[model samples]
Each structure stands twice: as structure tokens, then as C-alpha cells.
Target: MRVKKGPLVVIGDTLLDIDVEGSAERIAPDAPVPVVDVEGEHLRPGGAGLAALLTARDGADVVLVTALADDPQGRTLRSLLNGHLEVVRMPLHGTTVCKTRVRARGQTLVRIDTGDGRALARVTDTVRAAVRRAGAVLVSDYGRGVAGTVLELLGEVRAPIVWDPHPRGSMPVRGCALVTPSELEARRLCPPPYTSPDLAARHLTKALHAQAVAVTLGSHGAAFAHAGGHHSRIPPPTLASGHDVCGAGDRFAGASALALRDGLPVEDAVAVGVGEASRFVEGGGAAAIRLQSHEMGDRPRTPMEVAELVRASGGRLIATGGCFDLLHAGHVSLLRRARALGDALIVCVNSDASAKRLKGPGRPVVGQRDRVEVLRALACVDAVMVFEEDTPAQVIERLRPHVWVKGGDYAGRELAEAESLRRIGAETVVLASVPGRSTTGLIAAVQET
Candidate 1:
């Protein structure tokens, strides 16, 4: 947790995204197309708007600077973004762009595109000031003229910039902190024939004069290249398939910019972006983003919800399980160390019946509820959940944490949850327990006294 006071500014083009979902049970006799029985309509901000919204969802103060026409579609886009972001409007030369996707059974049937909106050549003083004062800036160019409009300002800004390039868009400004291009877009920019994304990133970094280039490889993660000739691949936690990837690029670019703002190294920032993009697609992508869901600013979330949010933001989620009968230094130490291993820590405590069964009669000096409360009070623990089973296998399945932790006592032996973890593609680690600290030892000492 790096926290920056300056707002994250997103500069790009905004589009209205409409997802029409329903069941397609029959094929039309006239055109041989599936006839979708309309159920409901979902509207959200698209392109740069989506990037800004994602940043805001991750608890950043986001300012979106984009062009919006005076058309009905533009108004809809603004309305959708009103409470989620601070909009700095630029002039648009045409109607607002709208992409309508008709889907059935989670599969897109057809896409209908409307409008040809592009930002005007003129730049505003407000946009200039916003860019200059930004803690971090994400240029989510959708090839809609906004990037070209602010190319000069972007070059002059001292704040770190993460440029999300488009095949049809303007080239990134010189001196960008990081440039993000999808594998397909990288091929379009540097041409194929070039072997791997690593080479593509290296060539683009030098060609664009950027500090670093991250070529996003979709579900495979990203290939990172620095101007100094160092390269590495950032791998996502899981490579599960059949996920919605509509807004994954925006999630990656937006998260990278925020991480850089928090003073993370370029490599770490790209890793954060990769993790966040993976989680975003896994959570149903942009289609799941509802305006009402984002209104909760700092409200408390459940353990599973915390896990989802952490994953969605490209942050790691770690889980530890135990009876936690009595709140002691040992428990605190294990939790704190576990938290330091990832972005958020989820404590899975055994239920009262389960604890009694595991520890025998007269055990669990503290009740399960009290133990849960104590764990939740710790700053190291992000959330706490109780499991009825003796082991946390079921809980782990639901949480799907990236890392599972246990006391050092389990170091030599294989954990019972190992198979469950393998199913979810998670890893397990055992931390060294305090030599003289234990709930059982404390109980024995009290009995002797």
C-alpha cells in the first residue's frame, strides 16, 4: 500500500457500452440467426471511461478527461459516469460512439456499432492542469483523437504515465513511464515476423522512447521490457479459460498507472496490472460493472467479497486457517506475517463444533464468535470467515485465494488441502511459528496456576 494524494487522471475517448442479454432458444427462419428473447439491458462506460471506473473501484480518486458530444448517447455515458468519476469534458467532433452487444448464454451473438465520435483538436486549460497535477496518468487511447490532442502535454507532465495504445490511435508521447499494447496491437505496431512478445516490447520501448513497454498476452499475462535492456514475463495466478475479456486491457493499464503512482517499481507495477486483468476477466469483465455497486466507498465487505475485490484489482489474496481458540501473540504473529505475503489476508477459523472436535473437550477457551471478532480487529487481517469443517478445504474452494498459509509445524508434512488448492491453482506456504507461543501452552499454564 502505497497511497498518493494526487488524483489519478485518465485521458482518452469515452464510449457507451450496452449489453443486451437474454436466452436464444430458436433460430430465425429468415436469416439463420438465433432469435434472442430480450431479458434486460445493461449500460456502462466504455473505453477510457471503463479504465477510470476501474481505478475508482480500486479506491482511487479518479478524474476522467475525455471528449463527449452533445448527443443522447453522450448524455447517457456522462450519466453513467457521474458519481463514479470527476469528468473533465473535451470537445467532440461527432456523435458519441456506442457499442451494443447482443448475447445469449454468455456468448455474444452480434455486435452493433454506432457513431463516429472523436475528440476535437483543441485542448482545454482544465485538461492541461489536470494532467500536470496528476499523481498518475493513464492515456487509454481508443484511437479517437484524444491522445493526439494532448501529446504535447503528456510529454511535459512529470507524473508517471501508463499509455494504453490502440492500433488506430496516435502513437504514445515520448517519455511515458510505461506503454501497454495488447499482443495483437503490438504485432500491428511492430509487425509480426518478430518472434516473441518480449522482442516486440523491446523494439516498441526504444521506438516509442518510453521508459518501459509491457506487451499484454491476454490470459498468459504480459511481457515486460525496459529501455535498459532488461526483460521479464509477469504471469497471472491462474490460467483458467472461458472468461470475458472485454475490459481486461483497461483494467491492466489502469492498475499499472495506479501502482506506479504508489511508487512501485515498473516490474512490480506490470505484475499488479497482470494480476488485476486476470481477476477482472474471471469476475465477468466489464459487463458485471453496475453503477449502484460502485457507490459503496469504504463499506465493510465479507471475506469472499474481499477476496473477489482484491483479485479484481490485481492484488494478491492470502488465506490462513486454524482453531484460533485464544487470541495470543502466536496467532497475531502468524497473521501479520501472512498479510505481509500478499495484498489482503483472510483468516478462516474453525466453527465452534469443529473446534471442539479438533481440540477435544474443554478446549477453545474463547468462543468462535469472539475469536472471529479479534481476528477481524487486527489491521493485518482484511476479513474473517468461519468454516464448519475441520479443515478449510471448502472455504478455500470458495475464496480461491492465491496463497494458503499454515504454521511452521506443518512444514514437513503435506497439507490435507493440497489437492483442493491444486484444483484452484493456488500455492501453499508454511510460516515459522513462535518457539514458545501456543494456545495449548497458555491453557496448560493457566491450569497449573
Candidate 2:
């Protein structure tokens, strides 16, 4: 099934991911180590940001609460997420957060972190505001930051909280929606009679006073004990489906929170979350933002091109573009709507290099090819194209579809290809959109907690 329409929010320690990939080969004559011939370097907004993005891509109007420094990385972060999501930049007092990866043959071998391991600064007000507006919140504990004070601040907010506990804390929130712990983390949080995974979930449920308790057992999937004396085992649904496994847990936690908040049954939500997680496991996380219009055949590039195609074929053209790294719900909705406007839709995807250049040290959560393929597979999309420039002006000029579309409220400003389109006689329409349904908001929410 596709995503449902709704509102959700995520709070956690945010991050940016730097992925470096290369082919592995034998080392030099003197050395005996394997040398990697670097093929590419990529940046992705991750952690809580990715989690929120996953939930949103699954189809929800989502918001994110995260921290960013007052520096270049932070600027990059803002720009990278500018059109994707709205951000509540809780200053970190330093460079924006980052994690660097060194990979070979599509396998990640090493990761280097660069950030001060401290909770986000000036967050109480932000937390209150977000909690007041959100349907749910996930307290992401990475052990790098988000201390007791942050938890305390979160407590004051009335929203349902889902705690993705780090090993450092005692109890998370008093009555959180659920407290999710890995087997290792649960081992530290659970008491006697909670020896096995099931027993551990049961004990933790009662001990924490939360609505439920979930213990993630990696490949073994997950086990849960709800507040109503109900117990079940939930295996990760998307574990075997995606590529990198690094952010699997975070994605699961996010999806689970969203499902629960949406009022789906515990087992059902867990299973759905697991399914969503499986989808991510095959990719990294799910798409951060969805620029959906149509999944038709690839043909024209511009509104004029679309109009001309339509005129020639007795149809109309619809045009849109975005980072579209993951093609989530927002994208799907946008694409579907775009298609509704005409007979065919034209989509321009930001190239990986372009996405990296725009999103910062870590962003575009998924690879360009994967994103393109995903868009191509969607039933709503007709044609897809890739643009290397940060903006889609050149692409807009070339494609020249019948109409140009974008999500959100951008009524006053000139669109990237508007002037050119007008000069060439193409129709321009600004979609009156819902705020907080963007990739940036998804990223910010995932990164904050």
C-alpha cells in the first residue's frame, strides 16, 4: 500500500553523512593491504533527519527538530535542505554535525565522526513548539549528544514521545509511546525475568511505564510488549531489501513511531514499520522527499515540450524537479497531482554530484541512479531526466513541458525556469502547498533529537 496523508514529527540528534566509495584492489608492492580506487564521494543528511524523512516519504506531513552550527557546514546544510524541508536550526555552537564513510565495492569499511558530543543548544523553546505541533516525537540517542537536559525539556512537551534509547540513560520519558532498544541496549535497561528478548520486552514495558517497549534484535527482527499486556515479535520487514544497513534501526524507529501515531495496531504498525524498514534496507533509508507527479514514460523536458507533446498527441505536459534522492510520499503526491494537471509528466532529478553540492557534506540520502529508477518504477511518472546543475534552469529550458509545478507556497518568487519558459510561451503555475511536508523538515526532525 502507499502512504496515508497525515502529520508526524521527529526529534533527535541530527547528522550529515559523507559516503566515499571506491573499488578494492591489491596494495602496492611494499605493502600488503588492499587499496581502494575511489570512485565517488557523497554527502547525505542523516540520523534523525533521515528517520523523519523516512516517515514523511511513507506519506505524512512531517516536521523535524534538529541542530546545526553557525558555520559553513551549517550553511551547506541549510541550502541542501532549503526547498526540501523547513528547519528549526538549534545552534550547535560549532561546525554542523558530520560522519564520513570510506567504502570499497559498495561496502562501507570505516566511518569517521566530526562533531562535539553535546546536546543541541537552545532547544527548550523549539522542543515545546514542535511537540505542540506534532503527532509524535522520537528521542534519538546516539550517545554522541542529546543529554538529560534535552530529555527533560522533551518531557514538558505534551506530544507522544518515542524513545530510541542510548545506553547512557536510566529511563527515557515517564510515559513515552514506546521505548525502543537494541538487544545490547535492552540488556542494560531490562531487569530479571527479562532474560530473553521477549522477557526483556515484557519487563522493560512495565518498568518504563511506557505505552509499549520494543527491542530490536538485528537480523532476528524485533520483539515488542505493549502497554495492554499484549506481546509480540516483530522482525525487521526491510532488512533484506536495501543496501547499506547502517541507518536501519533509526528508520525502523521512525516508521514505528509514525505507524503507532497513525493509530495502526501495535503488531500492524510494527509490521508496517518493518516493511518500510525492509524497503530502506534495500536502499539506505527511504526517500527524504517525494516530487511525485506521474510515473509515465520519459520523453519531454520542458512545459513547452510537454504542451507540444500534448498538442501533437492530444495531451498535456506537467513538469517538476527536485533532489528526489529517495522519492518519498511528498514526491508521490506531487507527481500524482502533477499528472492530474496534464496527460504526461516531466520530472528532473538532481544528479548525485549536484545533490552533494547542494545538500552539504552528507545528503541526498540515496544514490542518483537508485532514485531515478525508483521514480521510473512509480505508476504516476511518465518520463524522468537528470540535471547536474544545482538548479533546474537548464533542464527546464531543455525539457520545456506544458506546465511547471513545485510543492509548497512559492507564489511571489520567480521559478528556476519561469522566465525562460515565459520567453518561449509556456504556462507557469505555483502549487499552493502544505507546509512541513518537505524533505528538509524530514531531515531536521531526524537530526534534532
TM-score of 1: 0.68
How does residue 289 of candidate 1 score in lDDT? 55
Q: How does each model score on lDDT?
A: 0.84, 0.67
**Residue range 260-343, candidate 2, lDDT tens digits:** 777776667667656555544543332212232222246554445555655665445677888886555667856754654555
lDDT of 1: 0.84
lDDT of 1 at 349: 91
Per-candidate TM equals 0.68, 0.63
* Residues 221-241 of candidate 1: C-alpha lDDT, one tens digit per residue: 999999999999989976445
Q: Model 2: number of clashes?
A: 65
